[model samples]
Target: MKSTKLIYMILPYTRRELPGWGKLFENLGGYKSELWKDAPIRTIRGKFHQYLMTLDLSSWHERMTYFLGRYYELDIQKFMIEAVKPGDSFIDVGANLGMITLMAARCVTPTGTVHSFEPNPLVFKRLQANVSNNELQQVTLHNCGLAEGESELTLTVVNEELGMGTFTKIPQQDESLISNQYQLTVYRGDDILPEELPGITFIKIDVEGFEPLVIRGLDRTIQRLHPVILTEVVPEHLERGGFSVKELCEIMQNYGYQPLNISTKRSGLRHHLQLTKLTDNQMTENVLWLHPENNLSSRLEKYFKES
Candidate 1:
């Protein structure tokens, strides 16, 4: 089976009565439903085979919100077309539903590898399903969460709807929420260092508010691999976790990284911040960092050219 053809099987099994299935089909067969009209789809093609998968595309308003956020939302298809080397390794720390994992797998085709870690059970199930459905041969999925220490930790559900969880100390006032909360297994990066794992060239961390903890665990690994790390650092979340944005920047700088000023309007590089400004009460959603003295400007120039 060709790699491209696997996308057609990248589907979620459904028990829910879809509009075009069973009894519902009889009533809507001739109708023009918006759901079907705007169904998300992706096409994959290899040398001689092609396949299509139906993705759960976001609404226009949701997309607008994503655009409003200064985050690097790469073009997955184009990324697959370029950038990924044959033997590179990519790690996705906060892989939600394996969207970026799938994209990473597609880009790192042939012999590259992708390590995806997701802790939320609901999202983890979906991620596993997507990885299997796509028949991604080079992707490895892990269920354990990463943090500063290796131990069993109680994670409070911050947003039940989005399945976001936090491992920070929950307020004593929120004991009721903690009672029914789920506890997850976690491993420190020092316990499983970069030398132990395969070579890692890229890492994406988006553990809502847990970035500092994750980095603390990976201090040695970062010094060793020095992979291009993309992390989201929300100030409020950091403060709640006992850190601040300035401190986080200092931590990254201590590890030899310079903060990259990501643009809020477009997918282009801006002037890198020589020194990031932050207040004791300042809050920003996301930021990107690159290794100091790294020729990131030239790299981005080359990447945008080839990509």
Candidate 2:
């Protein structure tokens, strides 16, 4: 059971105030390093939420900012809500505090389930806390990092101010606090998925520079599920990692998926997942792809012809 008892204590107003809180807790002897503890419960939108303390998180504003920033993009939720079939499963990689995971959990409720993974232990704690607080029994949280294979790698914390992080195949050239780095355990989704996860129907991938590596690990899963894949295409980041946008699309196509630019006008339910190459639209950051079985291409073509 989740520990929902409230700790009515003062928060540190300055850096100097932190040590006392640390010492008081440390003296309790139950405070273990990097171990997760249940926090006071709060309510929002008629849902009770548990605030998880994560050392990796820079500040409280980090969670607030992430939620507020993506509030306007309700479109992502709409797609899953409309497209997901009963008993389907959704996978979220680079789940970062699980802003999208919460939505997936609610939409795929009753029969469907959500499998979310976050690399940063700090972020994973918050994600798990939120899931538990909301009583989201259908969403399973994994703390493991996703990569090309089951291996070890170093991850760089981008900046506390930006609340972002990145992983590299090799260590950074120069070490700096802004580029705070840590060695982490990595596993391929192909190798990591449990034997019993229901067939995945949708997937969202946004692992910064490590997208290719993460996708490479999921080739078998992608082929088997033919799930709708929503991924971010960072041309510069991919280029830095020796991957190109073209190569990424080709990889998806080989798995029987077509790229569907969300910017295009929609005609039918099926068009929501069609792959439309966005070579012309340079302004957008990410585009989605749909399996041909989803029938988005034909719906789009018919609409364009009629238009």
Candidate 3:
């Protein structure tokens, strides 16, 4: 058995249901990650494909996927599979380690194209490695980020997983906490994407608190393509970046888009997500927005258990 598995064996299978207990078990096993800080890379087979990742218990993304063989968010994973069809063009903003990008590659097939953007150079390297290891030819990766316009900006990466990155003017944290900053270039999706990669049908934006800027950058493309967008909408993250949930909702509404909250069940072996229309008062962390004119929801009605 792999060393990582030995530590993960005690971790809860139903992570969402038993987070506290899971952590207790992990602590009992000394899997607080000091144990395998230098462990060898392991082969982990996921729902979509296998990954050659350096498995670690410390990284939340890895820990959940290590146990489940997929991303922690079951609904978003299911939606990506259902929403993106073969020969469709999909974009992954803030692609992280290319977990979603890898899955999208499988869905799109060789005929389709998947464009992934990652600003953190280290994470981008892993993203490139994963895509190459999987030998997905349809994917085109950019080492920079997309934004309202072309400009140089600072990227703040706050964890080992490199998923919690932000371009926001963040508040002052403790001096002891570790953060790495890098200068990155940003481009407007309108000025470049349409001419290079036309016919984009789907986009997933998880750019920490910079979600609003990304949407603004791709405003023209969204108008033209009316692609299905899966964007993160955490209120705290938005506030850190000087954005608000109300502003995000208004922006989408003005663009003729409606929202459905994306989340997973509390506990389940089979991970299938049902989409329901979100009300104005609902607090949404992740929202899947689509234009009524495009009528995209009509085609994917099986997934919606609207209440």
Candidate 4:
């Protein structure tokens, strides 16, 4: 298992040096094979720890690759593991399959708590199964979604891509591909979490295009806790949701948070972290937002220096 993990980590970087081998591997059924057809539940080690993941090969091939460490987002996962402490409280919005949620659960164990929210009934079931299989007692799962207000909203689930579920209010071009639609309850974060959570340190948001609504709901929570946030920033998706990338960034800026580009470049056996101004285009899927007053930057610096 460890050897396989090392190969998955090194193969991507090695492929850059030997470009011709890509074709050779493709000819050997490497990319277009039914590798995970029979495997529904696979246990793989993440960058920080090992956990079980429920797989849906039908619509989640990319996510299955992530679980296998073949094409995982190691840098983002590493940052999350380093940012959370043992007693910290973390919130995972759009916790599909509990990947980051499980990582955060491991980081803040015994005394800490991880609150994960997933709206899609099918995906929530998988997320629940993963959490239960791992026996993460510190993790709490919610079946409803969060938005600026409390109301019923239409959630459209795409047949081929379950992860692409979005609010029907959002104007998505792929409406014809929707397989099912369900009315789900949406709540404001402040309303659900009335009291200040203990030791709140980190929050992750990745709700396809409804990020603005999610942030709107967490306005008071951000003002009070000021946790380090990691959120997806897809321009097209935001526009579909009736907002722009600039609008999202400005909203975070209002809460005293600055957007920084989180990138990873390989250097020998290490993946070096690069924090710079957000200059990348919409292709950069995720960005880290940190409050000016927080010590997260210094803490990350210390972690990388020692590593």
1-307: candidate 2 lDDT, tens digit per residue: 1111111122221122233444543343223322223322333331211223222212344322222222224446545555654566888998887767877776677587888988787777778877887777788888888888887777767655223677743335434445466678989898867545553477888877677888889888777666678888887667756777888877776787656555433344222332235442341456677777754344345322210
Candidate 4 lDDT tens digits, 77-129: 76766677788889999887777888888888868888899999988998898
Specify the highest-TM-score model's number.
3
Q: Candidate 1 lDDT, tens digit per residue, 209-299?
A: 7888899998887877677677787766677688778888778878977654333222233222122333334424545566754333443
In model 3, how large is the Cα lDDT of residue 4? 52
Ranking by lDDT: 3, 4, 2, 1
Off by over 4 Å in 2: 1-43, 46-72, 161-163, 169-179, 195-200, 263-283, 294-307
RMSD (Cα, Å) for all candidates, in order, is: 10.6, 11.5, 3.6, 5.2
Model 4 / residue 121 / CA error / Å: 0.7
lDDT of 1: 0.57
| Whole-model alpha-carbon lDDT for candidate 4 | 0.72
Question: Model 3, poorest ten-residue lDDT window?
Answer: 10-19
List candidate 1 segments past 4 Å from native: 1-84, 170-180, 193-200, 264-284, 293-297, 302-307
Worst 10 residues of 4 by lDDT: 1-10
Candidate with top lDDT is 3
- Candidate 4 stretches with Cα past 4 Å from truth are 1-47, 60-67, 168-173, 279-283, 302-307
Assess every candidate by TM-score: 0.65, 0.68, 0.86, 0.82
- 1-307: candidate 3 lDDT, tens digit per residue: 3555565555344333344545654554444566556645555757554544444545655765766566667677778776777888889998988888888888888888998999889888989888888788999998888899999999887655577778887677622343688988899877766444433488899987888899999987887788898998888888888889999889888898889986555444454667888965784778899888765676688777765
Cα error of candidate 3 at position 40, Å: 3.5
Count of clashing residue pairs in every prediction: 0, 5, 0, 0
